[model samples]
Target: MVNENLATQVSRILSKHRLKINDRTLKRFLTALESINDVLTPELIEILVLDNLTIGESYFFRDRKVYNFLRKILPSKSDWTVLSIGCSRGEEVYSFSMVAKEVGANFEITGLDVSPQRIEEAKVGCYKFWSVRFLDENELESFFNKVGDKFCVKSDYRTNVTFTAGNFLSTSFDKKFDIIFARRVLLYVENEGLAIKKMYDLLQDEGLLVLGLGEYFPQVLEIFEPIAECPCVYRKIQRKEIATTAYKNVSEIRKTADFTAKPRAENANVKDESKKLKAQKEVITKTLERELNLEPALRVVEHCLENKKLIEAENFLRKLVHNFPTHYLVWKYLGILEMEKGNVRIAKEYLKKAAFLNHLDDEIWQLLRLTKGNG
Candidate 1:
């Protein structure tokens, strides 16, 4: 028997969050709701129990291929750290610990969930016999000891696992780990881009990042190269630095290398050198123009200012303002750069143009005061 109103509400919530809830699961949830209502008061139900209902179902070795890959790659005796994000009720963490033990690996397993109540329940290390319905009867019997009717996790295996409460929205980093298991968590997040970026920052260099089977984001894959494809897991690709040499210096080096060449080819070489130099100058000019062409190029200007390259950046800004005189933000940025170099007079002129274009920016008032003081 299902409560139609409750079922519809639950369905609506699931749909709002972009989660697919089958009719069967909705019916089961309705039955659970009825059972809870029978025991608990309405106020308590409204306050706590209803919002914290666990929807994700799991089993021992849920993805056999992923487990197999883990078993194959992981060393037998080494210090390894694994983070299981959105781990509900400790089942996945326990399963990981069991697998690590079987593989004879020395490891630390951490389970994180947003629900404090679920974390407390997970800390107890007890579960109902039918909770692991996906496991074989023999396997369940072997892993659990009879504590009345409920199956409790063995004590020896329970010591290595720890549970913590965490939220993905906060940008906090405590320690980097070797492997982060974020399976089935991304589907629930509002902004998948930020979540993927956060996960990238959390993982250490050469660390493995595992995701669920159906979960796929192209932007994530573009940033992180796929190492193991079948299980659809990806590892962060180590960024490589591009080698840069000054064009003039490269030409000089080439000339030195070919110093003893014949006279007839010397003319051709000189012409080539002239063409290369012209091309190099053109490139440099274009780059400078592009760097200055941005409106309110705060990031670029900041970098240049830090490196004591304000003159170069200013030169670019001057050309940029000449090309686009109406760009108020660029004028303001140019004013800031000029102020940085102690050119108060020139800075005042740029500030006036910026203020005339857009008088709303408050910082221009301060700049005007500073310029007047300098005068």
Candidate 2:
């Protein structure tokens, strides 16, 4: 059970920052707070909980397809260094080890996690039998030695791997790596765009950054193109190189004059326009919600409208006006969505309600005239 005062404080902090904290997350927050409160005070507890909450569960060769891809593309070098960020226990780092051994590459692997206890456990390199389920009996016997109830990594393999406890937000190393495997860590960060920019700076020229199969970031995708999609991996291309490549591709297509080529440019422009509209809609909706105590229905309607989901936006706005008759902003947005949908009669009705609430705005008067003309 959580202390009610503590839970309220946590909730207030999250809400003040406009973060969405659902019931499940609140429970996790409470549990994490209780676990670390003995060693940390209230002020430091949130930071510690945030650091320890990022440990992701993994299995041996969790995604075999990604490993297969790595086997193909990883350079066969005598001295390569690989960094795995947020490597929870040792599974992914060990997976990298297995791959390196198979490719006959002499490699050093560093696995960093935020939890000191997890780092200690990883240093021991001892795991339960079930953790190696993917390995055959002979392979397991070859790679690990039985130690009491657990299996310890074989000495030959153990020397190449090191586990360190470090926070991703503040940690830095003097050396650049040939490969940085950040996997699913970025999705949980408070500022993913800034984090990606930092990661981009850490990569060597032509170096690889492998995000996990299911990981997706709109911000990262804008900059990094998919080099190999089989494993859903991305490579950090130099900005100048990407520009040069695009220029060459465009020049070639222009010379060829293929009808299929025009659509690609048009699609790029459309995507840019869509992004701008979405940003505008978010600004407007957030401002209104924060300043006016507007209904959530109106905000959802505005989002859908900005994303060009006209029918859904209209329906949502109509529902808001119907359910919350006293909310003027709901009526205002309903009118806007209706106008965008070319339904002037419904738009006029909604604009009337908005006019009743606040008659001072010139824009409202202009929209009312336009709606009346259409009706």
lDDT of 2 by residue, 28-139 (tens): 7788677756565655654444344444565566556667877876656567788988787777888888777877778889998766666777788888754664454566
What value of lDDT does candidate 1 attain over all alpha carbons? 0.65
**Clash counts for the predictions, in order:** 0, 0
lDDT of 1 by residue, 183-208 (tens): 77776665777777778778877777
RMSD of each: 27.5, 20.8
Looking at candidate 2, the ten consecutive residues that score lowest on lDDT are: 247-256
TM-scores of the models, in the order given: 0.51, 0.58
Best by TM-score: 2
Q: lDDT of each prediction vs. the true structure? A: 0.65, 0.67
